[model samples]
Target: MTRELDLVVVGSLNVDLTAAVRRHPQPGETVSATALSTSAGGKGANQAVAAARLGARTALVGRVGADAHGEDLLTALRADGVETAHTLRDESESTGTALISVASSGENSIIVSAAANARLSPDDIARARPLLASARVVSVVLEVPVETVCAAARAALESGARLALNLSPVVDLPAEVLAAADPLIVNEHEAREILQRNGSQLPDGEVAHAEALRAIGARSAVVTFGARGSAVAEPGRAERVPGVPTEAVDTTGAGDAFAAAVAWRLSRGDSLPEAARWATRVGARSVQHPGAQPSYPTLQQVLDEPGLPV
Candidate 1:
């Protein structure tokens, strides 16, 4: 029998091409760069690897191309103990790629060439139903087709698994699936864009935004304010958790790290507040390193967090 997974992530998979620059370029301006590098990425894959490395029995259900990039991606996930049995290889499209520029301050700007990631359809979601249904938590990012995301969400809901949705590179979410997300994860910018596009009554502060996020559709919501920390909302109350103080080297995958930590803690039976606290510690640690997957800390490392928030 296939072992049940702690978290099953269904979305995109990609290879990342990155460069370190002094700062982000302004409109119509160019800047010198240093240290070009490549790695396995894509929000879905990043979150899966992060959770797996942290000892979650994690699986990835996404698509890549039938090429070298796809092979490398599989190797990376397997190295981190992420189950890739459900990850598919598409003969029609090339593997996805992301062009990333990281400034010295750890902030990054990314441009994605979606390729095979864009081709992950609802049909693909159906193929992974058993894996999705057996997971304790099913998480997804807005990298693949939105319909595919909805299919995964519906499957998880039907199976009574907790659903965590990250609306990154934000897009309009279907009402049914959006409401099914137990904790709708969005960074501050993504949150604002989603609310505004959906014509949600925009709230003023982080706490209020989190509350508003819950009001919209999510059973619970978390609005992350980078450096400042994050605010979470459940039924009875809402509160803010301060960020772990750190000097960051690169902010790539920080939000993915946060989402994975939340899912991992939830799978371990931690409450929202408790989960957010641990997530903050993990996110802060990610910014101290350079890539997405490489920056993630092990479960033991998180346990040894010196300044983890209470």
Candidate 2:
């Protein structure tokens, strides 16, 4: 019997400590915050939560420390109905954390302390092999060791699952691994970094960037253009999908939310552009609230969104 999981996110886990500020502090200057809060975050955990909330059978494969913070993170994942069987607790390091500053304009800056997340070794990936193999889409990010991500991509390919790789934090990847990705997901800036680093001229626009990304390796590519929407590119095709309007309070996990939506929809057999359309709506929904997981919408909510295509 083949066990089927919609998505399995393998990457970092972090506890986000965020502060509300009128504006970001200058390099040598200090700024006062209006409020502060703590939330469960991490590329892996956030993506899995977004998929699970949208009615996907999702799981998280990653590491957290055996601290109280880790316990809270585990609780939060379980609360979101994400399978945590593959999530491990490392007693050696403390839980990962991110220091975040949210500006009034909905933009945010973050500093991450990888802590236990950095300790997600190849062995951890070996242990999660079964879960990875069972998933229809294996979502990977660069928060953990790059080697682990490459290994997961290999596993996804071997298991006949699609690899949805998000090259955030903009690290160089081996061409083989890049080629294995079914859809390489990146924001406009990350796409530029990847393209320019490979001696390819940066594209002038979102759809062009997506096309450039596919040229390097990925079977398809999606480049996010913030509130303007996203562009999808594959062999001989590139198109734009406009973004949905929403009252955005925080943009913290918008990208992760978009990735999650894309992964879930792709796992269910939607085409890349269709998946990105749904992802745009999900990303828009994510910004309407204050935190990452807190802002995620349920499948019904997205389905009921105004102006959804019939």
Best by lDDT: 2
Residue-wise lDDT of candidate 1 within 162-262, one digit each (tens)?
99999887888788888988899999888888888888867888899999888888899988998899999989979998987889999999999999999
Per-model TM-score, in order, reads 0.97, 0.98
Model 1 lDDT, full chain set: 0.90
TM-score for model 2? 0.98
The per-candidate count of clashes, in order, stands at 0, 0
lDDT values for all models: 0.90, 0.91
- RMSDs, each prediction? 1.6, 1.0
Q: Candidate 2, residue 111: CA error in Å?
A: 0.3
Q: Candidate 2: where is the Cα deviation over 4 Å? A: 1-3
Lowest lDDT block of 10, candidate 2: 301-310
